[model samples]
Target: MNKYLMTIKNKQYIRFFLIPTILCLILAISVVFVLLNQRKGELVDLENRSQLQTSLLSEKIAGKLNSLELVLSMINQSARSMDLDNETDRERLISLVKSQLYLQDDLEGLCILSPDGSKIYSSFHIITENLLENQQRMITTHTRQDISFSLFSFIDNKAWHLVLSRSLFDQSGDLVAIVGLLIETHSFFDLLSVTEIPGLERAILFDTAGKTIATWNQKDALGKETIHLEENIHLIPSFSDSNILNTQDQTINAGIKTVRFENSLLTTVKLGNFPLSLGMETFIDKAMASYDNALVISMSVLFLFIIISLTVITLLGKQVIEQEQVQQVMMDELSEKVKSRTAELEKLSTLDSLTGLINRRKINSLLAEQIDNRSKEPTFCCIMIIDIDHFKLVNDNFGHQTGDEVLIHIVRVLQQSLGPLGTLSRWGGDELLVLLPSHSAQQALDIAKDLLVHIRDNPFSPDIMSTISIGIAQYREGELSSDLISRADTALYEAKGSGRNRVILG
Candidate 1:
C-alpha cells in the first residue's frame, strides 16, 4: 500500500519525534513528583507552625481574661468590705464605682442595681425603663452567689453588650445590691484581634455550638444572631491535650486525623474556661503561589522548546525538496508572536479590567514616585481613601455582575468629578484612592464634599442608592507613603463610625 511506503520513508523522522516526546513525558512526571514531595514537606512545617501559633493565641487570650477576672474579684472584695447601710459608705461606694469602674477602658459603663431591681446608679445616662426591665429580668435569671458574666444581650435593641455582675451581701448574708459592668461585644473582638497570624487565610472564633462568633476576615458576621452550625461541624475539633487537629483527607470522617480542608490546613485551639474555639486556616495554594508561578513559566518554556524541536524535525524531513531559508522564516515568525503575547500579559498587570482604572500595583508605584518627589514640591499633596458604603450589600443582593456595573458607574462619576487635577485608582475591594498634587487640605476637603453630594444625588441603581465615605490625609514632608495611607485609613474608619457618607480629614 502507498501508506505503508510513506511510513517506511518517514521512519527516521518518526523515531526522532517519539524519543523526545517520551523523554518530555518522563521529565514532566519527575517534576510533578518532586513538586508534590516539596509541597508535602511545606504543609507539614506549616501545620506545626500554625499549631504553635494557635497555642500562643490561646495563652494570650487566657492571660488577658484571667487578668480581667482578677480585677473583677478585687473590685468585688472592695465593694463587699464597705457597709452599704450607712449613707457615708454609700457615697464612698458611688465614688469608687465612678472613679474605678467607669474609668476602666474595658468597661463601656457601670450600673448598680438595688435588690428590688431598681437602678441605683449608672455611669452612662440614667437607665431607660426598658433597659431597667431587661436588667431586672437578667438579675432574676442569673442569681449566682458569685461573680458571673451574662450572655450577650442587646441594650435597648441597639448594640450587643455583656454584663459582668457581682452580688453584694451584708454581715447577715442578706443581698443588698448587684453591681454590673457593661462590656460592649467590641471588647472581645479587640481581644481576639491579637490572634491574627501572618499568612493565615482565615481566623474565626466559634462558640461550642459551632456558631460563628467573630472573624478576622468577615467582620459583618459578628452579632449575627441567626447564624448556626452546618453539617461541616465535623471540622470542629474535640478538645484534647494535642491542642491541634489537621487532616489532608478527601472526605470528612471521624477517624481522620489530618486538619486539611480543601487546599487549606485547619488549626484550632480551645479558649481556656470559655465555650469558644479559635480556628485558623492557612491555604496551601497561597503558600505555594510563587513556586507554582515559576513552575508554570518553566513548563511554558519547555513546551515552546518541544514545539520548536518538532518544527525543526518536520522542516528537515522536507529538506529533500524545500529550502532552508523557508524554515528560518517560520522560526522568526513564531518567535515574534511569542514575544508579542508576553508583552500583552505584561501590560495587563498594571490595569484593573473591571473598572478600567490603574490597578493597585500601578497606584502604588505612582504613590511612591509622589512620595519621593514630595519634598521638592511646595504645594500640599493629599491621598483620599474613598469607600463605597455598604458596597458588600449590593454584591450580596444584586449579584456580582450588578456590583461590577456599580463599580464602573462609580469610576465614571469619580473621573468626571476629579478631572485632570487628581489621579484616581482602585485601592481595594470597593475602595478607591485619589491623589491630588498642588492642592491644599482645605481644597481637597471641598472636592471630597462635592463628590459625596454628587454620589448621593446620582443613584447607582433603582433599588440600591450608594454613598461614599472619604478620608483625606495630606502628605507630610518627611513621612512615608505607608504612614500617610494609614492615617487616611484610620480617618476612613472614623468617617464610617461617625456616620457613612461623610468626609474626615486626617
Candidate 2:
C-alpha cells in the first residue's frame, strides 16, 4: 500500500510538472507568433513612412533642379548680348557669376567655358588646368542639349559632384559657351538629413543607371558604379510594379518586400523628371531581436520576478512614451522654425533691402517666366524702365541715409500708383522696372505719363525735388525678356538724352 502511494505521488508530481511545461510551451509559441506579426507590421509601417519621406526628398531635389535650370537660363540670356572679349563685359559677366555663386552656397564652382574648352571665367580660385581638361572632355562628348545634369568625381578631392550645365546660344541660336555649376554631394545629402524611423537601415539615392549618387552617411559609396542595382535586385520587381503609379501629383504606394540577400524590407521613389531615385532599406531580424530578448526575460521570470518585471516595464514604457512625445514636439517645433527661416530667406533673396521692392535678379526671373507664358499665349506685355532724374545730385547734396529714405518713399508711391495692374521692381540704383501684363504700348505710355506727373507733382522731400525718366517698350511675339528689357533701356537712354522728366517709347 505504501509503495502504491509513493508511485501515485510521483505520478501526480509528474502530471503537475507536465501541465506547466505544456502551458509554457504554448505561451512561448503565442509570443513568438505575436512578435513575428508585430515585426511584419512594423516593416509595413516603415515602408510607408520611407515612401513618403523619399517622395518629399525627391520633390525637394526637383525644386532645386528647377532653380538650377532657371539660373542657367538667366546666365545664358545675360551672356547672349555680352561681348566677352570686351573687358567691361567680361568683368560684368564675372560679377554676375560671382553673385550667383554667392547666393547659391551649394555651388562649389561656377565657370563659363569657351567652345574650345578655354576657361573664360570662374568663380572658384582653383587651378584652371583641371577645369580645362574636364570641360574639354565634356565638350568633345557633348550632345546638343540646352540644359544637362551629370555626376562626376574629382581626382584631387574625394568630394563627388553634380554638374548642371547649359549651352549658351547667340542671337542666331549658335552655341557660344558652356556655362556650368558644380554642386557638392553634401548638398544632396542635406535633403535626407531629417528624422529617421527605427528599423531603417539605409537610405540611398541613385541615378537612372542604378549608380549610387548619394546616401545617408555613405560617403564611400558615392560615384560607385551600379551598387544599388547589384545590392537590390529583389527590389526590381517592386520598382517595376510601382513605376506607373509614381507621378508628381500622386503619392505612390510602394509596397515593401524582402531584400535580395539580407532579411530586409525595401521601398523606393523616383524624382520627378529626373534620372534619379531615392531608396530605403530596413533589416527585419535586427529590429525583431530586441523585442524577442525582452520577451525571453519576461518569460524567464514567470512567478518570482513577474510583479517586479511588470512594474519596471510599465514605468519604463511610460517614461519612454513621455520622452518620445517631448522629442516629437521638439522636432515639430524645429521643423517649423526651419521652414519659417527658409521662407524668410527666400523672400529676402527676392526683395531689395532698402526699398522693400523686388530685386533685379528676381524681376529678371519673373519677366522670363512671363515671357515664356506669353510666347505660348501671344499676349501683350509692356516693360517700362524708370530712372530717377538727378538722383546722384540728391546723394551729393544729402546723405546716403537720406537718399535711402527717398528711394523707399518713391517705391511706396509707385506701389500705390501701380496697385494691382502692374508689378513694380527695383532694377538697380535709382532705376525701377514696371511690368504691365496684357497691356498695350499706348496704355503703358499713359501709365508712365501718369507716374511722371505724380512724381513731379508730389516730391519725395520738400527740399529735394525729384522727377523720373520713363522708357516704355511693348513685348513682341517670340522676343526674349532680356531683348524686351534691352529695348526699353534704349528708350530710357533716349528719355534721359532728350530731357530728364520725359517719356520715350521704343
Index of the highest-lDDT prediction = 2
- The alpha-carbon lDDT assigned to residue 306 of candidate 1 equals 69
Write the residue-wise lDDT of candidate 1 on 24-71 in tens digits: 678777876787787678778777878877777666754655555555
TM-score between candidate 1 and the true structure:
0.48
What's the TM-score of every candidate structure?
0.48, 0.48
With a 3 Å backbone cut-off (N, CA, C), the pairs that clash in candidate 2 are: none
- State the lDDT of candidate 2 residue by residue for 78-156, as single tens digits: 9888877688987887788889988986788888887777778877677546555666655653344233333333333
Collision count of model 2: 0
As a TM-score, model 2 comes out at 0.48
User: What are the runs in model 1 whose C-alpha is more than 4 Å off?
Assistant: 1-14, 44-49, 126-137, 144-160, 169-175, 187-202, 219-231, 239-260, 263-266, 281-292, 305-506
Give the residue spans of candidate 2 off by over 4 A.
1-15, 80-91, 128-133, 143-156, 199-202, 219-234, 237-266, 281-293, 302-506
